[model samples]
Target chain A: MPRWEPDAVGRLQAAAIDLFAEQGFERTTVAEIAERAGLTKRTFFNHFADKREALFGPVSERQRELVVAEIAACAGSVSPVDAVLRGLQAAADVMFEERRAAVARRREIIDANPELREREWGKRAALADAIVEALRARGVDSGTALLAAGVGVLVQQMAMRTWAEAADGRPLREHLSDALLSLHAVIGQRSV
Target chain B: MPRWEPDAVGRLQAAAIDLFAEQGFERTTVAEIAERAGLTKRTFFNHFADKREALFGPVSERQRELVVAEIAACAGSVSPVDAVLRGLQAAADVMFEERRAAVARRREIIDANPELREREWGKRAALADAIVEALRARGVDSGTALLAAGVGVLVQQMAMRTWAEAADGRPLREHLSDALLSLHAVIGQRSV
Candidate 1:
């Protein structure tokens, strides 16, 4: 076991993002990331399976857990998509709204690296799966659950894109709500 | 210039799928793929940017173009999402419904290869972009176009999944319609 363990996961993530943005993700090493965080490589490994994991693993997993829990807590009176939107709102309240700059930096880092971008895509897909399971548990059928979950994730993507670009400091919760409305309009239009 | 060039693209793709499945995609070589198709390496290179490109490039691009063109040709009265569904239906009629087994095998090959999986994701994203552009050309705004396009792709994904399962042997166009109804129900339930 390594000795330096001061919020090792957070430290590793921040260091990895900073280093990836600085030296390019492919050129950066796990050892360098660990060293930047002032932790042993063993400590880094303990926190994350690898450098890419450090970038997205913990935070995404945490968000997934929170969203699912929130969805489960919702009553049957709420619509499936609304419950999902509420869960996404709860997730935004917890995981993203407070960490805007850091999340933006992380997105920038991932954008700069093709492998990291793929890993991010994989993480988004995994999160959609979690949302689908949560919706299913709320009595939605399998197919509808999958569709609602996908729409929710798409909303999240649009909100994040806007949030990252807006210098006026609009809150993610507001953006999330806006995205949900956009989704509704998109799906609500009358087919001639 | 290589002499052997009749239906070179199709012959090469069929040859590659056979060899990759028979000898494993990782073990298969471009030279072997070319020889198996009765074509030279120069002919293969002239047709595709690389070996992986042979598997996915032309078909996906053509599919996207076809969908977008079909959507654009629809009467101006069709709703954005409905236009997208029509586009998907048109593509399904031509590109997918006629080629179930081939697509199934291609999906299996992509499933087995991580790089191919990422490429599939990228292709889906590109298709979404194409749909969004077509919607915009029909006077839909950017934000709604993105949302409509994303929802349309979600429908396509749900349809694809249903089509892939052995139990759902219905034509892909039917599945696409079913998916659109499912989307309607999910978004319709919202008490906005």
Candidate 2:
């Protein structure tokens, strides 16, 4: 057997993204990803369940866990929207701050494929549900929890888009903060 | 020749929803739905592209058109989020006011199946996109348009849940207005 690699998952993901971008997601095979990563197919299987999972798997679970935990840890004095924003910010600081290029590439791959876009939507819905559950645990009303969770997910989406398109290299957390502020501004603006 | 039915699409949808809810979506066949509706398979095909579309077809397109048209007709001085709300309200008044039971059943059917849930999410995303495009046509900036559209969708979701769960027979538009107020209250609530 070959020596163990510490970053097998990261390597496989990088290789998969590169392959999916260069060719197409449908055209790229798992074996090619493993080969490009200088790893065996068995190792790839050990890391990811399938080719699609290689693009989005454990990372989403980890992000969800981080966000939920952050929400749980937030002070009760914080407002519902602020609590959700804090949770999202905490997750973004760790998971997405340094992965701008990878995230952009992943977005492109998902945008190009309807199947991947469907899965992406599922993942997003799951994340929002998790946030809702967390908010409920904090004794928030179900209606408020759902709305705040939806807002959190929407803010994250807007922040991701702005961050991806930004020419300046700002951190994801900053984009998130800006997006939250923008949401406030948009919602607060009324016809005189 | 058989006599023509005025509500072929409605009959097919009702038949499909009943069959799907009873026997599960995968096990139910198009022919069974058509037979149950007292219509031929060709009639079902004329009404819907596939078994899945039977549950959600032209109604979604009509909802989109109503919303877009309402937004387009709103005065230029209207705020983006309010414009979206007005559009949603107009569509809800016409398309959803008397269809609470059917809407609830549809929600249950979609909730039970992951595949249907995915399609529902796609339809929702499409509606949001249409709203964004309408707002842009009115000269709203992309970011503001996106934010308003997201807020509008979020409010609609909250209103639907409330309207569905209410024991007292309240109109959907009232639930929508209440949801809008709740959103404002949630967002306005700040930590001192």
User: Who wins the TM-score comparison?
Assistant: 2
Indicate the residue-level lDDT of A91 in model 1. 89
Q: Which residue pairs in candidate 1 have backbone atoms (N, alpha carbon, C) closer than 3 angstroms, thus clashing?
A: none
Q: Report residue B53 deviation for candidate 2 (angstroms).
A: 2.7
Q: Give the count of colliding residue pairs in each prediction.
A: 0, 0
- Scoring each candidate complex against the real one, what DockQ results? 0.46, 0.56
TM-score of chain B of 2: 0.92
Model 2's number of clashes is 0
For model 2 chain A, the run of ten residues with the poorest summed lDDT: A114-123
State in Å the error of residue A189, model 2.
2.1
Question: What digit string (tens of lDDT, one per residue) describes model 2 on residues B58-173?
Answer: 88899999999999999999999889888999999999989898888888888888878777777778788899999999999999999998888888888988898788899888
What TM-score against the true fold does each predicted structure earn?
0.80, 0.90
Q: Local distance difference test, per candidate?
A: 0.84, 0.88
Clashing pairs in 2: none
